[model samples]
Target: MGSLGSRIQGSSRGAEEASEGSCAGTGHGCDCRKRKRSSPCQCDSEAEEEDSLLNTPRRKKLKSTSKYIYQTLFLNGENSDIQICALGQEWNLHKVYLCQSGYFSSMFSGSWKESSMTTIELEIPDQNIDTEALQVAFGSLYRDDVLIKPSRVISILAAACMLQLDGLIQQCGETMKETISVKTVCSYYSSAGMYGLDSVTKKCLEWLLNNLMTHQNVELMKELGVAVMEQLVQSSDLFVMQVEMDVYTALKKWMFLQLCPSWNGPIKQLLNDADSWICKRRTELGEEEAFLSTEQGAPFTPVFRQVRLQYIINDLASARILERDNILPHDWLSAVYKLQWFAMLRTEHDNDTGPQEANKEEFDLNSMRCGRKLAKDGDYCWRWTGFNFGFDLLVTYTNRFIVFKRNTLSQPCGGSVSLQPRRHIAYRLRLASFDSSGKLVCSRSTGYQLLTLEKDQEYVVMNLDSRLLAFPLYVCCNFLYTSPASGRRADAPEPESSAHSVS
Candidate 1:
C-alpha cells in the first residue's frame, strides 16, 4: 500500500510536469476552460518533483511499452463492469479509482445501495463538469498523479466538490493561489466563492484589494457582485494605489456600467421612468447620452457610503468626478461635504475650541505653531511623523502610494509642521529595524518636499527597495543640533513591529 501510494504520487506529478507530452497523448484543451496551453512548457516549476527512473533497462522498456491509455479501454468497454455518466458523457470507470473518494466509497461500499448497481449517474446537472478534468482524476488513481492547471481549476473544483474528491480540492486551491493575477482574479474569485473555499477566497480578496488599481475595467468591476465589492471597500486594511477618491471613482464607474449599459457598447433610448429628471435635463443641454443611471444602482450605495469623500483634497478633481455625466445625484456630494464639516466641527470642539463653525482650512497644520519651522527633536516634534502608535500610515513595495492618514493619527503635535521643502530638499523621515541578524536597516523618505501637511493630503515614498523592509520596525526622526561639544548619542525609542512587509 505504501509503495503504491508513492508510485501514485510520483505518477501524478510526472503527468502534470509532462504537459506537452500529456496533451500529445490524450486530454487537455478543455472546452470548459481557457483551452490549449500556449506552450506546454509554460507550466510553473512549483508543480512537482521528477519521478524516479526504473533501476534497469528491462523495467524501463516494460513501462514504456505499457504506456497505453488503459483507462480508455474501460470507456471502450471490451468487458466494462461499471458505467458512470455525467454531463451527457459516459465513462467506464474502474471501482478502484472511484472508491478512493469518500463520496464514492460510501456509495460503492456494502453499506450503500449503489453496491448493487453497475451504473452510477451524477446529479450535478447544473454545472458543466469537464470530462477532461474527470479523466485526470481517474487517471491519477491508475498510473498518474492529479494534474491541476489554473485554466481548468473552476471546472475541476465543481466536479471535485460533487465527487467529494479531497486531493483534487487541495490541488485546485494551491494552483489557484500560485496562479492568481490581474486577468484571472475575477474568475478565480467567483470560483472560490462558488465552492465555499475560504482560504483561496481570502487570498483572492487580499490580492484584489492590494492590486485593485491594476484592473479598472468597467466590465470587470460589474462582474464583481455587490457582496464582493462591499467586502473590498469595507476593509481598512485594503491597500490601494491612491486615496479613497480613486476607489470612489472606480466604484462609480462600476455603478455606471451596471446602471447604464450604454456607457460601454452604444446609446439606447432611456426608459422614460428611469432617472428621467436627470436625463431630460442632460438632453436639453445637448447631453442626451449623459445622465445618472439608477438601474441596479441601489445595491451600490453602501459602497459609496463607505468612501471617505472628505479625505479627497483635490476639490476640482473631486467635483469633476462627482459631476461626470451627472451619474451621481448632485446632492450626494453636498451631503458628503456637509457631513465632513459636521464631523470636523464635532471633533474640533471635542479636541479644543468646543464646537464653532470655523473654516475647514483653518485646521491646517500650518495654522498650528506657524507651520514653517524645521522638524526638531524638541517639544515641537510629535515623536516621529507626529503619529501616535503609527496606525495612520503604511508604505507599500512600490512606494507609489505611501498612505499616511494625517487626520487618522492622534494629533500630538496639535497642528501640522512644515512639510514643504526648504530650498531643493524635502522634509525627510526614516524608519529602522534590527534585522534577523541584529543589523539596523532603515527606510527613509525625502518626498514630502513642496507638500502641505493638510488633513487630507496624499504622499508617496521616493525609495523603492527601502519600503519593502520587514515588520516590527521602528520610526526615527531627530535633529541633533546641540553644540558639537555636547557629545551624546541622540536618545531614540525602539521601533514597534508595524509588520509593514515592504515587498
Candidate 2:
C-alpha cells in the first residue's frame, strides 16, 4: 500500500510539471494531451482570432475619432457659420454633437456651443447695410470721427460689393471716385486694371471728367487733356460729338455778339459740320447733349478771361525771351501800338460829344491860353479841351507841335467818363517846371507828367522833347476837369501810360 501511494504522488507531480511547461509555451494549459495526441494547441489560434476581432473595430473607431477631431478643430475653425450651410444633410445631429462636444473639446479645449452663444449676442441679423449706413459711415469719416484708413475702406468696399450691398457699393464707389484725383485715377486704371474692379475705375474716370468740364480748367485740361479726350471719344463717339456741338454753339454766339466779329461763312460751315458729326455720333450712342444752353444770340461774357490772362502772364514771365535786344516790329506793335489804337477806337465809339472849338483860343509862345483853363497861378493858366477822337493841333513858340486826341480830354463836369480819342489822345507830353516865385526861368516838356498838377491847376513849362512820340499810351482815367466857365478843358495832360501792355 505504501508503494502504491508513492506512485500516485509522483504521477500527480509529473502532471503538474507538464501543465507548467505547456503554460509557459502557450500561456494556457495544453488540451492536446487530454484530447487526441495529433491535435496541436488550438488555444493560441482562438486567442489571436479574438484579439484581431477586438482590435480591428477599436482601431477603426480611433481613426474615426482622429478624423472628427481634425475636422472640428483645424477645418471648422476656418469657416464661418454661413459657409457651414453648404455641408448639406450629411451634417447630422449626432455628428454635430460629436464635433461640437467631444472632438472640439479634445482638439481645441472648447465647444462650438459656447462660441456660438457668445457670437450670437454681438451679431445683429437683418441689418441693412445700404445708403443709410454708408451715409452715416461717410459722415463720420468726413468729420474724422472714424479711424478707418483708406486701404481698409477699400477692403470694406470690396466686401460690400461681393455681398451684393448695392447702396453701400454705390456709396463707396462714389466716394472713391470723388476722393481720387485725376492723375491718381489714371495710374490706378493702368496698373490695377485686372482686379475685377473695372466698374469702379470707370466711375472714377467719369467723375473726374465731369468735374473737369464743369470747372472749365482749360490749362489743366490741356495738360492731361488729351487723355480725357481719348477716354470720352472711346466711351461713346456720340458723346464726343455732343460736346463738340455745344462748344461750337458757344463759340459762334461769342464771335457774333461779344467779340464784335461776324461769323464768316467758312467758319459757320466748319461749326455746322462739327455739330453734325457730334449729333450723328450721339444719335448712334442713344445719348443726348449734356450741356444745353438756352440763349442762342446772347453775348459772350468771358468769365475765365482773367484766369486765362493770369496763366499766360505767368507763362510769359517764366519763359526765356527769344529776342530781348531788338523786339520784332509786329511784336512791339502788337504789344504797344495795336492796343493803343484799339483803346483810341473804343473811346471814339463810346463818346457822344462833339469836337472841341478849334479857333477860339489865343496862342502865345510864352503864354498859351487853353480853351478851358485847369490851373492858373498868376499870369499863366494851364488849359485843356475836352477829349476827342480827332487830333488837336497846338503851336508853341519853339518848333514844337502838340497833337491831342478827344479821348484824352476831361469833361469839366464830374461823372463817369470814357477815354474817347475825341476826348483823349495817346500822347506823351513834357511839362515845364517853375520856381515858387512864379518866375519861368526856362521852357521845356518833361517826358513824364507831374501827377500833382490838378485838373485845373497850372504849372510853368519846364522841358519838351520829340522822344515822347515813341511812347504808347492808353487812356484809362475817367476823371474830367472843367474850367471856371464850365467849358471842357482843351489841353488836359495826356493819359498816363502803363508799364506793361496787353493785346
Candidate 3:
C-alpha cells in the first residue's frame, strides 16, 4: 500500500510540473489551448503568426472622394443629370454639383425655364470666354481645386464672371496680379478695367509707374494707347530719367512707335528714326506750324500736353530740343515761357524761399522729375542740370545711404542755388532694382513729403541694407521747389527771355 501511494504522489507531481512548463512557454498562467479560438495569446509564436497574416503585396491607394467624383461625373459623364452647352461645346453635368455655381443655383432654385429643362444652352456674350475655359469652369464645380495657367487665367476669369463663380473670379484676379510683366501689363490693365477688377488695374498702373522709365521696352511702348500714355505722363509718379525733358523725349519715341507700328527697330535707334520721321513729315506737309496742331500729330497732343513745359524750358539744352522738335503749339510754349519768367523774377527778387506747405495738386502737376541709374555699387554724386528756381539740389550715394545736399556754396554749380536760411521743398524719392526679366526684386519709396533744408546741409533720404542693394539700381525723384504763386508777382519785372523766346 505504501509503494502504490508513493507512485500516485509521483504521478501527481509529474502532472503539475508539466502544467507549469506549458504555462511558462505560453507566458500565460492559464492554458492557451483551452481558451476560446478568438482570444489573444501572449506567446512570440502567435505574434509572428499574426504578422504573417498582415504581410501582403503593395497596391496603389484609392483616389480621393473629390477626385473620384470629378473623374466619373465630370470626365466620364457617367449618370449625369444635366447638360450645359456653351461656346459650341457641351458639358455633361449634375444639378447637385452645378448648384455650387450661383448662376446654376439661381436657375435650379428659381422658376427659370432652365430649372425644368434637362439641357440648358448658355449664352456667352463675353469674347474672352472660350471652349477650354468653359470646360475648366464646369469641371471646377465638381473638383476640390482647379489649376489655372497664367496665360489662360484671363479666359477663365471671363467664364467665371459670366457664370457668377466668385471664387474662381477671385483666383483669376490674384493670378493676374501675380503674373503682371512687360508682356502682360497692358492687356491686364485693359481687361481689368473692362471686368471691374479695380485692384488688378491699380496694380498694373503701379507696375507701369515703376517700370515705364526704369525698364523701357520697345514692344511695350508700341502697345501703350494714347489714353494710357496720357495717364502715365500726367501722373507725378511717372519715373523720369535725367529731367522732365526725358519724359518728353520718351513720349516722342512712344508717339513715333504708335504711328509707325510696323517699324520694329532696336530701342537705341528709335530716337533718331523718330526725329527723321518727324522731319520728313514736316517737309512733306510744307507746314511751318507746330506738329501738335496738325491732323497727323493731333491724336498725340493730349499726351504731349502732359509734359511739364515749365521744367523743360528751365534747361537751355532741353529748351533747344523743344524748339527743334516743333511738337508743341506756339501758344503752349508762349504761355509756359511767360509763366516761368514770372516765377524766375519771384525767385530773384521776392525772397521766395521754396514751398512751405505740401500743395499736393501743384506738386503733382509741376514737380520736376529726375532719376539716375547705378550700374554697379559705388559712390555716386551728381546733380540734375536745370535752373531749379534757385534750389540747387545735389544727390549723392555712398555707404548704401542716399544723401540729398542743398548746395549753396559747397560745390561750383552752373545753376543758381537758394541762399535762404531755411528753404522748404516738397519731394518724393523712389529706389528700385530689377532682375533679368525686369521683375522688381527690391524697391523703396518715400512718399511725397515736405523737407526743410539749410545752406550746405545734407539729409539722408534713404538708408538701404547691404543685402538688398542690387546692381543697376534706379533712383527716381520729384521735387517741387516753390509754391504755386497766388498771383504773378504784381510788379515783377519781365525776364531777359521773352514769351516768344523758346525758338
Candidate 4:
C-alpha cells in the first residue's frame, strides 16, 4: 500500500511540473519551438507568459487628505447631502464642508428653513460675485490652499464676503496688497473700502501717494473720484513735482479727464487740452464767476478746497494761472491773499521763526508739499518757489547724500531767507525711484521730524547707497515753516457753497 501511494505522489508531481513547463515554453515538455510564431499554440504560450508578468496588480498612490476631499467631495460631489442653487448653477455639497462657511453654517445650524431643506436656493445681489467666483469660494472650503489670480480677486473677494468665508477673504486681501499697481490701485481701493479690508485700502493709498505725482497717468487720473482726490490732496505726503502749482496743474488735468473720460490724448497735450476745454466752457456759459461756484464745477469744490491755495497764491505766475483759469472762486483766492498778507507781516516783523514744537497734526494738514525728479546721478542743488515764512529751504543732492540747508546767507537765493538765530521746521523727506511700469523699485523716508537750523546751517537728511540709486528718482519733501498757536486761524473764514459741479 505504501509503495503504491509513493508512485501516485511522484506521478502527480511530474504531471504538475510538465503542465507548468508546457505553458511557460521553458521545458522539453513544450513543443512551441517547433510551432510557427503566429500559430495559436505559440500565441497561447506567449499570452500565458505575458499574463504572468502582470498577474500582480499595480499599487497606485493614494490621494492626499485635502486633494481627495476636494476632488471626490467638492468637484465630483460623490456623496453630497445638500444642493446649492445660485447664479443659475447647482452645487452638490456636503453639510460638513459647508459648515466651514459662516453663511452656510448659519443656514444649516440655525432655525432657518434651509436647516431642514435638502435643496437651498441662494440669492446673490452683489454684482461682483459671479459663477466663477462662487466656484472658487466653494472649492476653498474643501482645499487647504487656493490659487487666486489678481484679475479675479475682486470677484472672489465679493463672493467670499457674501458667503462669510473669513479665510478666503483674508487671502484675497493679501493677494490684492501684493499686486497693487497703477492700473488696479483705484479699483482695489474702492473694493477694499466696500469689503471692509482696511489694510488693503491703506496699502492702495500708500501706493497712490507714492506714485500719483511721480508717475502720472491719464487713465489713473480719470478713475480717481472726488473723495479719493480730496484725501490725497489734503495729505502732506503727496509727492508734488517742482512746486504746489504743479499739484494744481495735475488736479486740473485729472478733473478734466474725470469730466471727459472719452477724451483720449497724449499726456503732453493734456494740460493744453484741459485749458482749452475750460476756456470754451467759460465762453459758452458767458459767466465770470469761478468754475467751482458754477453748477458744473460745484461737485469738485471739496477737492479744490484741499488744495493749499496759500502756497499757490504765493507764486506770482501760479496766482495768475489761478485767476486766469477761473476754476477757483474769487472769494477763495481773496481769503488766501489776505491770510498770506498777515502771515508775511508776522514773519517779517513779529520775529516768528516758524514752528516752536513738532505738532504732527498741524504739519500733516498744512505742510507745503514739493518734489523734484533726478534725471540722473549727479549733483543737484535747488529750492522750491514761494516764501516759506522766511525759512528759505535749499535741497541739495550730491555724492549720493541729500542735504538740507537753511539758506540764510551762505548762498544767494531767489527768495528771502530768515536771519533768525534759530528756526524750527517740521518736515518729512521721502525719496522714491520707479521702474517703467510705475512700480517702486527703491524708496526711503525720514518720516516726520522737527529740525532746528541756524543761519547757513546744513543738515544731512539722507545717506544713500550708490548701488540702490536709480535714474529718474523722485524726491518729495513736506515742510511746515509755520504752525498756528492753537486752532485754525480764527480770522480765516471757511467757505461753503450749495451747488454741484459735473465737469
Candidate 5:
C-alpha cells in the first residue's frame, strides 16, 4: 500500500505476507533462516522484512520521505508547532518548513525565547501584506503548483517579495505577466514597482507604451506615473494612431477626474482653474519627499509640459485647451502653433526624397519612389489655411484632376481631416499638393481606380507601396457616389460640395 514496488510484489510472497502484516524475507523467515529451516511463521521477521522492503532503494526512500514531510507540514496542520498570524488569522505551520525561509529561520534558529516555546506565534509586521497572499505563498513551499488568483496575485507577489522566497517570487511574476492586460496591468505594474519585480515591470512598461496607454485606450493613461508619461511624450517611438489632440484630450479627462470629487462648482469653472485643484497621491514618492502636497499645479504641471503641443491640434481642440486654461496660455498657444508649423516643415523636409524640380508632367506613382511628395493618397493633412491656392488640371476618361496648391498638408499635429459638409457627391478624387506658384509639390491618388465615398466610415488607405503612410496623417476624403456595380457611368460627377480651408 506504499509505493509501486510495495503494492505489486511476487504473487506468492504477497499472499504469504497478506495476512494484515506478516513476514516475507528472502523466502526464509529471519529466525528459521538462521537455523537453516524454511519456516513461514516466524513473527520476528516482520520488522526486518518491512525495513528491507521500505529501504531498499535510496531514490524511493528519498521520494517517500519528501512526500511524508510535505503531508506532515501541510495536511496535518493541527499538529503544527508554529502559529503564524497574518491578516487577522492564525495559520499552523511546521517549524521545519518555516525554517526554510530566512524570515522564519532568523526567528526560530536563534536562541530566542520564542524558538523553544510550545506555541510560537509568528507575524510579519507589514500593513500592506495580504493575508490571503501569505497563505497561498506558504502553501507553495509545500505544494509545487499553487493557484494564484488575479484578485490576490498582487498581494501574493508583495508577500513573496517580503519573505524573500525567490522561486515563489518568480512564479508570482510569471502569473502577473500571463494575466497582464488593460484591466489588470495597472495594478500589476503598481505591485511590480512596489515590490521591485523588475522582469514584470519591464514587460508591463512595454505593454503600457505599445498597447495600453494610448488614445484608443486613454483610461490606462491615468494610471501612469508622471515620469513615465513624460517619457512617453519624449519618446519618438510612442505611436498613437489617432490624431495628436486625442492624446491631449485624454490627459484633459484624467485631469478632470482628479478634481471633480472635491469641488462644488461647474466643470467648466474647474477646468478653467485646474491648477488650483488638489488631488491625492497613491503611494509614497520616497524619503522626506511627499507623494502629493498643497501647491498650485504641483500635481499637473509635469503632465502639461509633456503634452507635445508641436503635434497638429485643430482649431476646436486648441479652443478647448485655451478655454480650460490648465495647459496653455494665449501667448504660449500662439507660439506653440508657430512652433508646430516649423516642426511640420522639418518633418516634411525629412520625409521628402529630394527637392525635385516642379514636375507636373510626371504623374506615375510607381515610377517615383515612395514619399509624401511622390505617393498618392499618402497621409497629409489638408492644410486649408495654407492651401488657398491651386488650379484644376484636366485628365482623361471624362475625368479632371483638381490639384490644390501643395498636393497635401505637411505633417499633422492635430484634428480630423473632414471636409465641411456641403451639397456635393464626389465620384473620383486625386488629392495632391502644389507650391505657391502652381507647381506640383506632392501627390496621392487611388491609383487608376475611382473610390466611392461612404458616410462616417473612415476609408483610410495606406499603400504598402507608400511607406510614408506609416506616420499618422489625415487624408482628405471627398463626398461622391460612383456605382460601377450598378452599370452606372463612374465618371458621371454629382454636385460638388462647397468647403472652406481647414488644417
Candidate 6:
C-alpha cells in the first residue's frame, strides 16, 4: 500500500510538470518545468497575487496615481475659531486643504477636496454667521443689473486684496475707478493712504487730479482747492498746475470784469501782473506759456488783441445798465457807441478809421437831419431834409410808393417848405411830370397837404405844380427804391418792421 501511494504521488507531480511544460510551449524540456518545483510555481503565484491586489479596489489605485500636494495657510495668527461646519452641511472635512482670512481680522477659509468639490466658510466674531447668507450678499454684489454703490466696491476691493484674489482685486479696482467722482476720489485717497496701499493710492490720486484738472472751476474746486493747489505746487506737477492756474486766472478775470468795471486800470494792472507771473513760472519750469506778452518775439498778437477787446467789452457792459424807460445820457451813448465801433474794428479789419472816428460820424448823422454837398474828394453826396412836424425828416434814394419816416418833435410848419442849401418855399409844392416846376405838365394831379413851419422850424416838400404832397413815412434813413419792372410787385405784403434805427 505504501509503495502504491508513492507511485501515485510521483505520477501526480509528473502530470503537473507535463501540464506546465505544455503551457510553456515545451513538451518536457521546458526551463520553467525543469526548475525546482516549489520555486517554479511561486513566481507565477506572486505575479497573480499582485494582479489580484491591483484589481481589488480603485480607491487604492487612485491614491497611488494622484501625486498632487496642497499647501495650507492659517491667517490672522491662528487664534481664529474658524468653524468648519459653516462651510456647508455636506462638506467633507477629510479632503480640506487650503484656507485664508478676511480683511477685518474675521475668520474666512476655503478648502478643496476629492470629487471636485470646494467649500468656503466665513466666521465673524460676535455675529451670526450663515454661509448661504454670506454667499447671497456676495452674489448680489456681482450680479448683473444691480446698481452697486461705490462704497461697496471699495469694500470688495479691500476684501479681495486681503484674500489674495488677484483677479477680483483687478476687477474691483477698475470698477471703482470708473464710478469714482472727484469728491469720492478724495475720500478714497484718505482711505487708501491709511491702508498702506501705496500703489492703489498713487493710481487713485492720478485719476482724481486728472479729473479735477479737466473740470477745473472755482465753485467745484473750492472744496479742497487750496490743498490741491498746494499739492501741485509742492510736487511741481507743471501740467496739472497749468490747467488749474489757467482756469483760476480766467475765472478771476471774469469775476473782476463783472464786479469792478469802474476800476479798469487797477484790474488791468493786476491781470498783467498775474499773466507775467504765469509766464515766468512756465519759463522756469521749461513749459510754454500761452498769454499775450508786450515783450519782443511774441507770436500771438491776434489772440492778445481779442482777449483785450473781450475784457474792454466786459468792463463796459458791466458798468452800464440798459433801462428801457429811461433816456440814455448823450455821453454814455457816445461811449457805448464808441465801444461797439472798437469791437467791430477788432473783429473786422475792413474799416480804415478808428472806432471813435466811425462812431462820431454815426452819432452826428443820427442826431440831426441836414444836407451836405459832396466835395471833390468825397465818395458820395448826401442830401437830407430837416426835422420838422410830427412827421420827422424821412429820406429815400428815389421816388416810390413807399415812404421812409423818422421820429421828430412836433412842428408848426403847415405850408412852408425847406429846400437843401438854404432854399425855403412858403407855399406847398407839387409833383408834375418830374419837372423842376409845372413847366412840362401832362395832366393835373391831386396833391396831399403839408404842415406849415414856424420861424425856427423846418419842413420838406417836393415842388411840382406848386402843390404839397405828404404820405405815410418809414423810419429807415437809407432806402433803395425797387422798380416795378424789376419783378418788385407793389401788391406784395410788406416785410415786418424792425425796432432798430437805420443809418
Candidate closest to the true structure, highest lDDT? 4
Candidate 6 per-residue C-alpha lDDT over 107-188 given as tens digits, one digit per residue, 9 for 90 to 100: 2222323224334354443122244433323332222223435656555555455444445555655655565555566655
Better of 1 and 3 by lDDT: 3
**Ten-residue region with minimum lDDT total, candidate 5:** 387-396
* Per-residue accuracy of model 3 over 86-190 as CA lDDT, tens digit each: 867888889998888898899999988889999999888899999999988888888768989989988998898888888898988999998999999999999
Candidate 5 overall lDDT versus native: 0.48
Q: Model 3, which residues run further than 4 Å from truth?
A: 1-62, 410-415, 487-503
lDDT (10s digit) by residue, model 2, range 1-503: 56998999999999897764454456565655566535555875777888899878442334455555445543444332311111121111222332322323343345645444322221212233333333333223112223333334454454343334445445555555545553345443432343346676775565443333222222233234333444532221111111222322333232233222332344345445434544454354343221121132112223211111111111232112212211112233235334334434333432323222222121111011112111322222122332222323222222333322222245445433443222211122323322332222233332312122212233333333545322111111111121111132322323434112211
Best by TM-score: 3
- RMSD of candidate 5 to the true fold? 20.0
Whole-model lDDT values for every prediction: 0.50, 0.33, 0.84, 0.85, 0.48, 0.34
Candidate 5 per-residue lDDT, tens place, 1-110, comes to: 57777666666576864433533544543344244334444555566688799978754334665566567777568578777765577777887877767666776779
Instruction: Work out the TM-score per prediction.
Output: 0.52, 0.19, 0.83, 0.82, 0.48, 0.24
| Superposed model 2: Cα runs more than 4 Å off | 1-148, 151-163, 170-503
> Taking the tens digit of each residue's C-alpha lDDT, what string does model 4 give over 1-503?
56998999999998887554455544435566565555667557567888998796788756787788998999999989999999899999999989999998898888998899989999999999999999999999998889999999999999999999999999999999989988899999999999999999998988888888878899899999999999998888787887889889998999899889999989999999999999988787665677888787999999999999889988888888898888888888888888787677556555556776768887888888888999988999998998677787888999999999988776465456667688888889988898765668888899989888888889999999888878889998888886563354735433334111211
Residue-level lDDT tens digits of model 1 in 1-503: 57998999999988776653443332434232234555333223222222223332342344542245454554444456778887677877767667887778888876777787899887675364778877666555555456677788888887777778888788888888877766677788888888888888888886665445433454565577777788877654344333455566566556655655555432132222233534455566553233333444456666666664545522456556456545555566677566445433322232211112222222221111101111222222122222111122322322323333234334446343222111011133344443332233444434223233343344554443534655544332211100111122212211334111110
* Model 1, total clashes: 9
Error of 6 at 102 (Å): 7.0
Quote the positional error of residue 220 for candidate 3 in Å: 0.8
Model 1: lDDT to the true structure: 0.50
Better of 3 and 4 by TM-score: 3
Q: Which stretches of candidate 1 lie over 4 Å from their true place?
A: 1-80, 260-296, 313-339, 346-503
Give the TM-score (vs. native) of candidate 1: 0.52
Q: How many residue pairs clash in all the candidates, one count each? A: 9, 55, 0, 4, 17, 13
List the pairs of residues colliding in candidate 4.
296-501, 296-502, 298-501, 299-501
